[model samples]
Target: MNALLALILAAALALPAHAMPDLVILVRHAERAAEPASDPGLTPAGEQRALALAEALAGTRVDAILTTQFRRTRDTAAPLARAQGLQPQVIEARRGGAAEHVQAVADAVRARTGTVLVVGHSNTVPAILTALGGPQMTEICETSFHHILLLRPGAGWMQLGYGAPSPAPAAGCL
Candidate 1:
């Protein structure tokens, strides 16, 4: 009887301690200049899409906002940031800070009780996801508008959610 009771107690205690965050949102910066040599700000269509994405996110629980140190990324997060009344926290991954940034974000997520938003560029987005350490990520070529990627945690792990941006209008065709 004693051995059986101990086994049952151990089994009950083996359950996970904490619930992983329900959402890990990944959003690509809105559209920018076609010509790389020119402006880095969002194009008109990108701006429109940003607004649409913002509206789409309205009333959702966004506990935190993270972004890269780029204009397009900052612009992409502005609407949600404003609505949440929280300044965007820059991830600073490019300045030889990828490891540190990843650790800091992991710590933040572990400490938090709800969803966290992270906005990144085409280059560093996959790295962030990879650092969270569930599976390898494939490079994603981003275009169109309102591109959204979501991540969520599961049985002792986390996984990705991916979606392409909505198609641009005919007038906005490249």
Candidate 2:
């Protein structure tokens, strides 16, 4: 674990001071409508949740946003990005599996400084959190979208919830 943190920190050292973040915020994208499954956008409820996310972090200084190319992730990040007057950097989900995707996102994040919000899918969020030096995390419940995973150097991980509470664990997805 020490070696991993050292490696992550070493990679981050080259970035400018303003780009070096003391905190990294990771979250699964908000809810999605059932139609057009390939690249579904946020549902009305999800939009509200996104706004809630923006409001939740309004007081904090977020210097950068990272998101996948998917519509749901982009839409989920939109509110916060707009609120901060920053564009969310879109990292393609890419082929090669979850580890590859996680590395891509993690590397992109390491290159920047300041606080950042990474909008990833349920499957990706757990790995991304771990890569950012947070604790090992299982995927959020499929129905879950309210979890906000916060990580800072020497701070470990803290889980917080915003917007509507997630429904109890059940089955399937939209």
Candidate 3:
């Protein structure tokens, strides 16, 4: 009886000891073409910033990536996607600030990946955070650098804050 009880207790303790997702990176699209008439592609500065962000995340284990269906957002995630050797999974652009889009990505990340990066826009990034069960006011400001937001499976989420990734020395400017 004593041995059986000990085994059961050990299994129970080990259950929660399994690996959990560590980090979720939320990035707003970099500076876009000044004129909306030209279509929103990342500007030269934006491209430089994207490359810098990718370099900063080189050491992280990025299992998956998510982005909206926009040129700037896609371009912003491109470098990181290439570094991870994985294609960015573009979530359907949210219509009417829908929650389903956020839940779908969250569910996919929770079940399939250990770490996921989501690229979004200035207007909707905050909404995405809220939809992911974060606070309504969890605002990760739009910046050239990346913002690391941490979310546990069962526990609440928190913003791990920002990482500054200026353009590489060879690039000369950010």
Q: Evaluated with lDDT, which candidate comes out highest?
A: 2
> Would you estimate the TM-scores of all the predictions?
0.66, 0.85, 0.66
Q: Kindly give the number of clashing pairs for every candidate.
A: 0, 4, 0
In order of lDDT, best first, we have 2, 3, 1
Candidate 2 residue pairs in clash (backbone atoms < 3 Å): 19-113, 20-113, 20-114, 21-114
Better of 2 and 3 by TM-score: 2
In order, candidate lDDTs are 0.66, 0.87, 0.67
Error of 3 at 166 (Å): 12
Off by over 4 Å in 3: 1-20, 35-39, 94-100, 138-146, 153-174
Query: How do these models rank on TM-score, best leading?
Result: 2, 3, 1
Tens-place lDDT per residue, model 2, 78-157, is 98898889988998897568899999988888888779899999889988888877777667778999999898856777
TM-score of 3: 0.66
Model 3 lDDT, residue 56, Cα: 68
The true-versus-predicted C-alpha distance at residue 49 of model 1, in Å, is: 1.8
Q: After superposition, how far is residue 110 of candidate 1 from its true place, in Å?
A: 3.7
Residue lDDT tens for model 1, 1-72: 999999999998997676456777766677776655433877787777667667777878888888767778
